[model samples]
Target: MAERPKNDHPIRSPDIALPFCFFCMMNEPDPVLRTLKITEYFKEMPTRDDRESVLALSGLWSIAMTRPNNPEFPEIGIFECMAKLICRGISDREWLLRDQNVYIPYYAAHIIGSYVMNRAEFAEIAVESGVIPPLMELLKGKISWVEQRVAVRALGHLASHEKTFESVAEIGGGVVELAMEISSIFVENVYRQFFCLKQRLKYQRNLLTRGLGGVEIENRKAEEWAIQTQCWSLHLLNCFARKERHLNLLCKRDFLKNLCQIWGGLMIPEAPGGIGLLKTLCKTEPGRKMVADLEQVLKSLCVLARSSDERQVMAIECLLSLIKDPETRHRVLEISVLSLVDLVELENGSELKKPKLGNTLTQALLQDYHKIKYGNQKLHSERAKRALEEIWELKVEKKRREKLMSEKEMKKRKLLVGILKKQGNHKFRNGEIEKAAMKYTEALNICIPKMRKQRLVLYSNRAQCFLLLRNPESAISDTTRALCLSKQGSPHSRSLWRRSQAYDMMGLAKESLMDCLLFACCRIKLKHNIPCYAARMISKQANATSVFGCVKVRTFEETKSLLENRQWGNMTIGGC
Candidate 1:
């Protein structure tokens, strides 16, 4: 440079003390050496100074974000230094360090989490560095949700490793209880204290917005972080629950009730949230019995059972697991049947689709009902037969009426369908999706069976509403109905496309792949992304069918071969 920078001048100001030599700084550009030099400076400081610690931490935080796996930082006492800083931040009463201390614990815990994320060896080193106590302080709400988030995340990573798990677990029942408590309360706390505040700290704003974007982005990131905080705490609890250590604490009736309420929204796809942990608890007999005993919990699971969420299978599995246990089956059968009956007629397929688990559970329930209410005696069997015949006739009668309208009546009904369909379109455009679905239902209800074209449009339109409403099962049913109504030579492409999306939402990769491929082939000008979508579904299906405990993956050659063999001679449809 033509002129030396202010800070690089030979005469340093009283407030601006440089730790490393100028010649050394000019010669040493290596990140590892620079990190070690900073560590040495931190360790050698005669007295604690907020500014120096903050600068050192800022540098380390950047390094941790970029190259977390580097062992040199932790090897040269950085982990130990961070741990001590966290404790000092908690204990420091000086007004001078108070502001800086608020950020120290969050960064420290985050640094510890980052280093130990991928390697258990780093985690073991972190444990030896005495990071547990400081992290525990953050976990217990020594600061705020900002610190608590990183604290729980760091603890979860530590708990995941075999060597460090005991250290975290040894923190005892308090950790589990704290996690459970925090899981239920973190969402409200973050929302009220952070999002609701008129003026927030610069660090809080930076953390929320990641130093970019505006209010909407800040709100969205806040939601994602809030969910993450709750999910991480639940994940921490899941670790203990999986090992079957704190069953009594985890399975407490109030906590289980609170657990039932955690939805783990679509923001974090991989974290199934509280229901995931509840599903894990159900793997044991004690868990099944305790969960089943709560009719309220069973009812909540039933609601989730019919939802279009990714975790819908976990809810169904929990119910089926409960029903399989002889002690709890009767307690659950009545509530389970009410939700599962509508699903039985639908082909739920597999894990990717809604599970056909309902069929087996439903059949078992009916037999149990017949046995319990009507007995196994021959006389009771005859009564059961009569009851079954009456029920069958009721279903037959409803379908029989739809097909038996006169031409004059059909003409009047077709006009009514046209009007209702218009209203549905109007409602949907206005963003009133539920109202739109109802209008479509009204159109379908009165439209005669011969009006296949009108019914097809009505069904397809309603299915879109269901998809928007996140009711994939209903969407699948309506789409299937529309497909069935279309002429054999020309399947309705819109219905096929909607059903494919519904199937994808339910995690039925193979069915989704098949439907997506079929949709791509319809005689319509496809969207530019159609090919990519089909390819994605193929990749997902291939990954879905991977063999357990094997690193090797198989291609979707089988799905491709199956699609290749299918006949597609006459399907002509308009573009979606």
Candidate 2:
């Protein structure tokens, strides 16, 4: 056709090797075929280069598996292959590191971790294929920090599954012991750095006082790594301690002491997760009894309750769990009432509202003072009564403020409705029927149900616009509502007359006749001082004449038979 493209030329340079086709091979559309090809590629690997390629492919597969509707890696032999790779990586550790290929084992464990994340069955497979032991070894700082974090995270994932939790717990030398060791090391490092920083600051301040400026604190990277390690360890322990036996074992360790140290604002960021662990521990009787003895634990929790952070909710929950036991309740009450008042003060209009905290605290105080005994029982009772009264008064005041605000809002809406109605009337007078209807609709929206008279008038006014716009069905609907809202002799006869006209336009002859009959009766009762029975009789005669004049001959004949038996008045044709 035209000159052939360069890529189509048969003679190409041979020196430029073809671009690596790794993704093309992995993206084979059929899952089974793709898995088979990948497996064969793994088997053909006989060199370090081939192993590196396989490791890269493993990372890709791990990412692909996370997407919805992606083909799954073959479960039959994949875990075993990954496990073998991990084992090989452990043996080849020094060479891999020397070659800067630490990512080999990291990606291997990452692939295994991704597999076990949401599926319990695969977790069991990972455990059975001897993946846990290497992961545990990796946590001992034998590898890069990145690799260690990955291994810990993998263990955390595996430990979360019910089927593999016990196995992970066992292979890791017990979750409680492992987590305690890691947390202890982490806490120690944190405090050491903190105290060192404090002393350095003091020295710097002394220098400044002696005519030298202070030096800035150097940020340590290890501290960040320590936090991550501790967080992952806590996550693993939390998963394991869901069972009663593991929880009891955790309580036996000095877990509460370490947690209280963190809880006492040593590191404020860790309190949320620490309190969460406390909540879990208190689920059991022995755990509760142990936590009850830690006075620092109770005081720290009370302090946390007043914080405006999201952690406040968790703190309150943990406090309630502790106070369920009699001894713990007494211990909580021993904390000064002044400190507990924040826990009892209700937060109004707070995004993080916790109404239950105030109620629970009041109940605890009352129970401690009135239901249980102390040395100053009467004084405690009187204090408790006074606190209860204060709480009640606060609640009442909040309700009063809310009620006043609501009334103010209603008055504002009513004022807006009045303005919108006037705008609508001006539009209607100018023959802007659609604009008038829109304004009327806006007015109706702001009109409260208590403003029945205003709503009735708006509906009737909009019905007239609907009639001019040739929407007789809507007109009839609005007028019917207006009539229902009006009393018998009210000035709503115009609404009835308009509805009759709308019915006639819609070819509803029988409905039109009935509305006309009611309208005539209402008009006669209001205009003429006649007895109710006489007014109704004259109105029926007028209804017959009006129907005959408006409807077709066929409809009039059908209606005439229904009204022919009633007595007729000696009225002229124009009198009706």
After superposition on all CA atoms, what RMSD does each candidate show versus the true structure? Answer: 17.3, 31.8
Q: What digit string (tens of lDDT, one per residue) describes model 1 on residues 1-576? A: 132222121222234554333225424789777766656755753136534444456556778879988887777776787788788767764522333444566777889999988789999989998999999988887756788899998898888777888999998999998888888877766655555544444555655655567766776677678778888888778788778888988889988887776754433332477788888899877788789888889877875665434466678778878877777775666556555543433334345444445355445545544455455523224433444333233234444875676677768888899999999999999999999999999987776545778988998999999999999878876776676566543667778778778878987654565566666667345544456766676577556632121112233454334324433111111100
TM of each candidate vs. truth: 0.62, 0.52
Candidate 1: the clashing residue pairs are: 352-507, 352-508, 353-508
Candidate 2 global CA lDDT score: 0.57
lDDT per model vs. reference: 0.68, 0.57
Q: Report the number of the highest-lDDT candidate.
A: 1
| TM-score result, candidate 2 | 0.52
Candidate 2: tens digits of C-alpha lDDT, residues 533-570: 43454355345433112223323343344334422111
